[model samples]
Each structure stands twice: as structure tokens, then as C-alpha cells.
Target: MSDRPKTPTLDRVHLPSDLKALSDAELHRVADELRAETISAVSETGGHLGAGLGVVELTVAIHSVFDTPRDRLIWDVSHQCYPHKILTGRRDRIRTLRQKDGLSGFTKRSESPYDPFGAAHSSTSISAALGFAMARELGGAPDPALGDAIAVIGDGAMSAGMAYEAMNNAGHLGKRLIVILNDNEMSIAPPVGAMSSYLSRLYAEGPFQELKAAAKGAVSLLPPPFQEGARRAKEMLKGMAVGGTLFEELGFSYIGPLDGHDLDQLLSVLRTVKARATGPILIHAVTKKGKGYGPAEQAADRGHGVSKFDMITGEQKKAPSNAPSYTKVFAQSLTEEAERDDRVVAVTAAMPDGTGLDLFAERFPRRCFDVGIAEQHGVTFAAGLAAGGMKPFAAIYSTFLQRGYDQVVHDVAIQRLPVRFAIDRAGLVGADGATHAGSYDIAYLSNLPGFTVMAAADEAELKHMVATAVAHDAGPIAFRFPRGEGVGVEMPERGEVLEIGKGRVVREGSGVAILSFGARLKEVMEAVEALGARGISPTVADARFAKPLDRELILRLAAEHEALITIEEGAVGGFGSHVAQLLAEEGVFDSGLKYRSMTLPDIFIDQASPGDMYAVAGLNAGDIEAKVLQALGVERLESRRA
Candidate 1:
């Protein structure tokens, strides 16, 4: 299209090999073109923008210097892989990112040979790279043959323990592996903890870049005759500047604090390392998250994730909504709770903004804790707070909470600590795809002894649940809500504490009953409306507590209704499974009552709009109504179209 950037240099490049033919000067031109193309593409497709923008020059330098596909290149969290994708034969579909049947926002092994390993989570790249290196050593090669393994990981990702764990093992193995620490001084939120500070000190202590900072171990890269002089020169320079002693201690050679945007500098360092490095080596390349674009650099998150936008102005084309998002509602409600109770505290794992803990942090900075990317530490830390006589609300995304399950089970549930878990992104989150969905928390939490699990039907219910979690200091409690805007309901002045293990009947009827466990209650109501048109009014109830199972309501519904259907916004092992088990144990099934459970299918759903994903799961209103009819053995409905 005419709106697309003029990328004369990038247009000539269809694969990594194409960059090999270009001069270093021409390669710089390609970097500029690639940046422009990335901005243009993300402005249309509405995916990760700044991460890719930051790495434009790095992308060009790597592809030009190294043999990719054969040499496995891994991107930690892979949100920055957009530029890499555009250069590797996927530019034709670059504009279709994160859409249904489109190219994924993150790297996927199935997508292309360029992407050897896929990940959306952070800090796994070094481990994966070491695996590739070991595979190469063991003569276990796939087609095209594995050569070198290079991990381009962010400093934000370095906060996680896994990165260090991999480094430790890699050092012990003594394999030839390369690690590029892409330091942008930012993750999704500004990185927290000692790692960020440690990296800052490395460059801040002195003019290390001016010294052309390379580790003392770089002397080992020299030829035998030149090694003595190079060692002497390295020792002189090392005394003048700070070195990465921490990395060197971990059993790897550390080099850099290089200007990541300078293509010539990147190429020089990379070429040297590629030719001469033995064993695991670390290259610290400092970058800016939003390197080129003016608007992106100015934004708070550096325009980390964006919707389609006006290309020139960089004004996002977001659909306006009157209803407050579930995240905001939770934050506001929690803040209100904190006002009443001094002991109330909040915790998040490197996602204060995503979990809406940013609002809480603004109000109660001391009480709000961001534990960086360490979910296990965050969970256990929250448990310790509870044990210390403080009410800790660990607001984490459903997918991320999975990482802390062992802690949740041991530190909280087993000990009966009153650590409140506020699980955001509780369902199939659109655009981010299955990797980020909150589908297993219900099953996982509910099964644990003395754990209280709840799912809110709407924002109002979420507020009430927050209050309930505050009031009930019995055991480990969790309440899950979906990702986007809540259904527009009348606002409550304050949250109310509801009775534990109780459910509310939204509408009462006769032959069939629909039991909803979460946000899917809205869709159930819609299905109920449609069913009423056919002169079949089914009873609809919101089962507030999934763990306690609302036994009385469930049993009463089973006794009165001919057919009962349970619906939830989770995997098959969650709410519906609990209800089925209860019925089976209670002998309700022997009485010839028709029962059905609706849940997200066994397969991981791909990225699409929320509506489309729900449709695929067969959990939408039409599907619900159809399911009701199927359960009741009602073949047809009266048509209003005639």
C-alpha cells in the first residue's frame, strides 16, 4: 500500500543469506529500512512494537554476521521477534500478526526454520540455547544442521533465577554457547530488584564503552603468539574500568556494555566472538526500547504493546469503552479496601500495570510489592507477609500464577496462610493467544486442601469478592476475573462481604437449570433469553465459590430440574468437573437427571478476538442455547424470522 514505508534496502532481503551479499554500509541502510517497515507493520497489525523497534540494528547485524537457521537464534520471551520475522521470508504476512490464522506475535518453532525454539515467557532462552549447543556436540542434528546457539535475552528477563541456573549448568558443561544480554533497562514494567541495579552500575561506574570493554577472558581468543601482549593490554584496560565479575564468576566470559544501536560496533563484537570464542560467552549490548520513533520513546511503556495507530501521529486507534476494565475495577476496589485496613498489602510479579497493581502502588507504595519476574519468590513472599500478620493480596495473571504453584501449595495452602490470590486474565485472553490464558487456576487452586476458589461473574462481583477475601482470613483464597472490560453494570458505593460457599439465583424457572461459575454468566443469560423465546425458561444461577461447590444450590437445582448444565470459563478439569464429581458422589445421577458440563476444549486456542475464541471453545450464547436443547432433547425452536 501507499501508506507503507519505502524500504528499498529491506525489499531486496527475503532471507538471512541476502544480507551476506550487502556491504556493512549497505547493511546500515537495511537497518533503517527494517525499522521503518516494523513501525509500519505494527501500526497496522497492532502487536508488540517497541521491543522490535529497539532491536532493528541488532537484528540486521546478527543476520548479516551469522548463519541463521543452521545457527539457532533464540529470543527470550520472543516479543521482540517481529523485526527478525520481517527479514526471514514472513514479511508478506507481517501485517497479519496476532490475528486469526496470522503470524504469531512471538516466535514459534513451527512457523519457520529461523525460529528454532518458541517462547512467550521470559528467561528460558539460555537454557534452550545450551540444549542446542549440547545437541550439536552429541551429533544429534536436525535437517540444515545445528551450528551455534545464540540467545538474545533482555536484562528484564535476567531477573528470573532460570537464566542464572542455565548459566551455571552451561559453565559446568563447558560447551560453546553465545548469550547476548540485550539491556534496554526496561521489561514490560521498569525492571525491579538487584539485577537491574547491577547492570546500571556496570556502565555508570566508568566510561567502559570508551575503553571498548571486553572481558579479560577475551585474551583467550587471541592466537598463541599474540596472547601474552593481549593479556597485558586487557589487564591494563580492566583496572581502568569495571568488569562483569558476577558473570565471570558464574563460569562464562563476559564482554561488552556496547552500544547496541551502532551496527558497526555490534558487527565488530559479534564477528570476533563468532570466530574465536570457546565455551559459553556473554555479550552485554545496551539498547533503547523505543529507539527510533519519537512517540514510542515518549510513552510510559515505550509503546511496548499497541493497537493499530495513526502512522504519522502515533495516536493509537483504540475502541473507546464506557465500562471500566476488570483490571481497573479490581485495582480501585483493592485501593478502597486498603484505606479501611492498614494491614492490606498488594504484590505482583513484574506486571504491576498488567495486573492493575500500579494503581495500588500509587496509593500505597510501601504496601505494594513488585517481585520482578520471579513468580515463585513473589508467591512465597506474599505467604510470609500473611504469616507476619499482614493481609497480602498477590495479584498475578493466571498463566503466571502457574509458575508459583509449588509455592502456593507448600507455603500457603499446606500452612493455611491467608494469602489472597487475585488472578487476572482468568480466561482465554484475546491476541496474546493460549500462552497467556488463565485456564488452569480454578482446577489447580480448587483441588488444594483448605483453598477457597471463586470466579466473578462481572466487575461488581469482583469487588464483592475482594471484600470477601479481605474479611475471610480462613485459608488461601483466590478469585479470578477475565482480561478485558466488564459488563456495564450499576456501580456499587462499596464492596459487600458475601457468605462463603453460597450462590445466587439470577432467574428461576422449571425443567432445566444453567449453573454458571464465572464471567460466562453473561453469555448464559443471553442463552436464557433466546431459550425463553421458544417457551422454555431455564433457571440460571451464578455459583460464586468453585471450591466449596455451592452444594445446597447444586443439589436443589438437580432435584427440581429435569436437565442441569454447568458452564465456566476454564479448562475441563475446573468448575464443571467439580460439579460432576459432587453429583456422582451424591447419587444424583441415579435419579435419571440429565447433566452436561461446558468448558474450554482440551486444545490450546490460538490468538483471535475474545468472541471468536469463545466460539471455537463452544462457550458462546448460541452454543450454550444449543447445548441446553441437546441436554433437554428438544429438537427444534420456534422461528421468529417468518
Candidate 2:
């Protein structure tokens, strides 16, 4: 309790409406208290710490100035919305961030009216805000009576093509919209590409701080009497300052590279823009990632995503690991493969650290590519690399790879280019929730013609799959692995490339066969042991290749066992579906064989521990055991429900 920051000013303000009653001086204090409160809350229940911390004053100012809930405020990649949530009547539940049935870490429309649009993915806010603005003009939602549509986007998100797409459309429409480009100059990893460089130059030039405030509004937006003066001032400012011209060309009235930490500047600028803006406007506010927190500021990622940490010391309390994380293992394996083969090159979409490609980059600097949140381009780029006689490993998260599906199909699959896709976070990820869950890659990628899809059953299997992906140069190949630690199995000294379209049996048993895909083999083994207690020992086999189908192994399993159950940490139309199709085609089901496919439910599961999430998906050991009992027509006296 003593560790909790003193938030007396924050305690008085329950919502944005309550903030209206406070004076400007009190508002400044409120911003301070809000930052403190956000830090304290996140310290207890760790989440996106630095991004939220960066936007503290900006959040307070926006809510204070705007009539929120009516005025739609959309946060780009909303990981930074924790401070916004705290100010908008959710301070009481702030500590419950990212837990099961608790307040989501990102902005959720279902969670609060204050959250006008839900987003976890980056560069979406501008597009969503434009829609809202268009809707307001067309009288779409008359109930709340939409006032102004505002999108607060980060500079990192600006690197994506989608942000520019929205900007181009918004510029064409010429609607009265507000876009606050929160230029902290950092995304999860230090932002890359031309956008980062452009923003740096925008703020880095000569002293135009004096001319900036005077040229806030577009010349056409000002009164006729003041129009000429404003025009002259803008022209003078443009010559002296390197800022505003790029946005101006895009048909937006650009204002500032103002200090985002300054509440006074934020409030002043927002108030003026809200009162007098005539067309699309963009306010560039410069902020420091992990502002006001020494430890986070000192850290490389700016404390991007953290576990529960000490409030004062900023030391995270991580549980002791029994095994190396799947991410680290993948990195080590990829690095080793890169050593053997100089042709091996890596690519990531602004997720070098997350995908463990940072290690790859450190060893082979020139060979690695960080494409700066442009997944579509990254995929095509990897395809081009493959076409030019290089083994390109596009290491992307399963969920994010969806963005580049068309490129994967057209450029890689159709061209028969050998692009090795190291798909990370291959299952229901914890905390960051449904938006980030890597559920659909198995289904999406497996369905593609000439694409080879494999899921690693364990860390050792992951190593072998990496080796396999590097060796196979016929077509595009992908291997998926989950987010957490390995199953604590003994690892191989070196990965041996396995033959394609084959599977290995883990434990041989009778009556039923449990053909497992991905990391679920660990859970399947546990269920096998529990089934042993029930005198029902089921055969367990790891289906290494999902696309190739492992036809012989699957058919034999179906023929030998009374019932064949296929389990995978993926959605429907994946490994299980492929196996089912193979069985139906082979006439195995007609031979009195009962077949069941256990997969992730159709609905999107929310944030929780990965174990809890899989439990909800009904893919746990108990769920597997119950499923086997049901499949074999063997009733158990003990309730599996409990």
C-alpha cells in the first residue's frame, strides 16, 4: 500500500467530465497525478508501460479539452491507452489490466463507452477516426451526437503504409478531423525506415519554436481579415522550419513538433483546434518514450512490455524458467543455420526483438532486414530475395503474417520461391489477448497451394523444423511455435533435417490415436498418462507437416485405432481439417472408424494466462481426456467437468 504513488488529485477526478471542473493549474497537477497513478497501476499489473507513460499528459489534456464519449478518440495501437483508461472512469479497475475478465490492456469498445473504437494492431486509428468523422457528417449515430473525431497515432505506426492510405483519403475528403501524431520516436523496437528519419528532421532543424504557434491554423481556416497575415506567417515558417510541408502537401494543416509532456501546450493547442479547425489538421507533439521513469528511459525497448515490476527499483519479478523460451531456442537454431549457410538472410516487420531476430542481426548485420511494420512489403521483399538466389527467412508472428497473405500467395507461392517463414507466437498468446493471438496461420497458410506448413511439437522439434525450412528450396515453407518456454525436454546437439510429408510416433498405444500438431503434444502426453489411470491408453503421434498431410501415417493411425483424434493449437480448417479430408478421401472413415478433430473454438478468446486460455478453448489435458472418453464411448464416474 505504501508503494502506491500518492494520487490525491487523481482520486477526486473520476471521469473526463469531472476534469472539466478543475482549473488549468489543477489540470497540470492532475496530469502529474495521472502519470503517477498510471505508473503505480502498471507496476502492480504490468503491461505496456513505456508507451502509456509517454502519453500521460497528452491523455489528460485531450480528455480535459474534448467532450469525450461524444467526441470519438481512437488510439493507434492502443497499448498506450492505459493512461487514457485511467482518466476515463476506469481508474478503479486499472490494476486488473490484462487479467481474465478484467480491463483489457488496449482500448476495447466493449469495455467502455470512452473507448469509441477498439484496436490492438497499429496504424488503424487514422482510418477508424476518418470513418467516425464521415459518419458524424452523414448523421450515422445520432444517440450520443458525435462532436469531433480524433486519432492519436504514434510515429512508429506512421511507418506503416496504412496510416498514409488513411491520410490520403482524409486529405481527399477534406473533412474536419484531428490527428495527433504522438512523435515519441520509438515503437516496440527503435523505429526504422524513412518515416522515422523524416520525423527526426522535422524536429531537428533550426529554431522555429517562435513561429510555430503563430502558424497553427491553415491560412484558409482563419478569418478573412487574418487570412493574409496567417498565409505570410506560414510561408515564413516553412522557409525557416523544415516541418509542416510534407503534411501540408497531403492536404492537412500541420501544427507543431511541440513538447508532448507540456500540459499547457497540449491544452492550448487542442482548445484552439477544437474551436477553430475548418479541415483535416495534424498536431505533431514530440514526447519521450518512458518519460519521467528513469529505469524505463535507460532500457533499450523503453520498457515496452513488462511483467510485474518494483515501483521504485523498476526490477521485473520474472518466474524462474525450467527451460529456455521457445523464442530464444528458435533464435539460437536460426543463428546456427545462418552460420552453416551464408545464403541465409532474415526479415522482420519492426519486430526484431520480439521475433528474436535481434540476435540474428547482431551476428549478421548486413544480412538482416527490419522492414518497419510493412508486412506486405516484407513478404514480397523476402520473395524477391529468394528469387535472387538467397534463402530468406521472414520471421513474423502468426497473427501479423495475415497482413501479407496476398503477397505470400502471389509472390512466394505462385512463383514457387523458397521463403522460409519462422512463424512465432503460434497459439493463443496471453495478456495481449485475442488481437495478437496467432490462431489462423495454420489454417490460412496450409490452404495455400504449394505452401508447406509445419508446427513444432517441442523446442527440439523447432530446431529440426528450422533445419528443414533452410534445406527445402522447392517452394515457400513455414514452421510455427508457441510463445512461452519449451516442455523441458532434452534438446539435440544439432538439428537433423527430416523427410517431408512424414510424422513420428511419441508413445504407441491401442484403441485410439491422438495425432498432435504443434506444442500441444506436451498436453497430449499428460492426457495420455491420465487416460492410463482410466485403463485407456491412446496412441500419440506428432504430425510434423500440416500441408503435406503425412498421408501414410494418418491413414495407418485411422486404420489401426478404433477412433482417431487430431489436436492442434490452431483454428478450424487447419491440421485436423486437412487430416479429416485425407481420411474421407482414403475411405478410412467408411471402415467403421470414428474421427474427431479438436481445435480452437470459432469465437475469439480474451486475455488470460496461456493455460487458462487453452482451457477455455477446451484443449487442455482434462479436455483431451474427456474428449477421448467421449470418442471411445467409455463413460467415466468422475466428472471431467470439475
Could you tell me which 10 consecutive residues in candidate 2 have the lowest summed lDDT? 213-222
- lDDT per residue (tens digit) for residues 1-642 in model 1: 998889888899999999999999899999999999999999998988999999999999899889998999999999999999999999999988999989989999888989999999999999999999999998887676789999999999999989999999999998899999999999999999999998987777554554444432245555789879866665576556665368878888878778889898788788888898889999889999989999899989998999999889999999999799999999999999999999999999999999999999999999999999999999999999999999999999999999999999999999999999999999999898988988899999999999999999999999999999999899999999998899999879999999999999999999999999999999999999999998899999999999887999999999999999999999889989999999999999999999999999999999998899999999999999999998877764324333
Q: Can you give the lDDT of residue 426 in candidate 1?
A: 94
RMSD of each candidate?
2.2, 2.2
**82, model 1: CA deviation in Å?**
0.3
Our tally of clashes for model 1 stands at: 0
Summing lDDT over every window of 10 consecutive residues in candidate 1, give the lowest-scoring window: 209-218
lDDT of 2 at 297: 92
CA lDDT of 132 in candidate 2?
Answer: 95
lDDT of candidate 2 over 1-642, digit per residue (tens): 777888888888988999999999999888888888888888889899999889989999999999999999999999899999988888889999999989999999899999999999889999999999999999998997888999999999999999999999999999999999999999999999888998888777655655564444234445789878876776776776774567878999888878899888788788889888989999999999899898889989999999999888999999999999999999999999999999999999999999999999999999999999899999999999999999999999998999899999999999999999999999999999999999999999898999999999999999999999999998999999999899888999999898988999998999999999989998999999999988998999999999898888998899899999999999999999998888888888789999999999999999999989999999999999989998987764455543
Stretches off by above 4 angstroms in model 2 are: 213-227, 240-244, 636-642
Model 1 misplaced regions, further than 4 Å: 213-227, 232-244, 636-642
So what's the TM-score on candidate 2?
A: 0.97
The lDDT per prediction is 0.91, 0.91
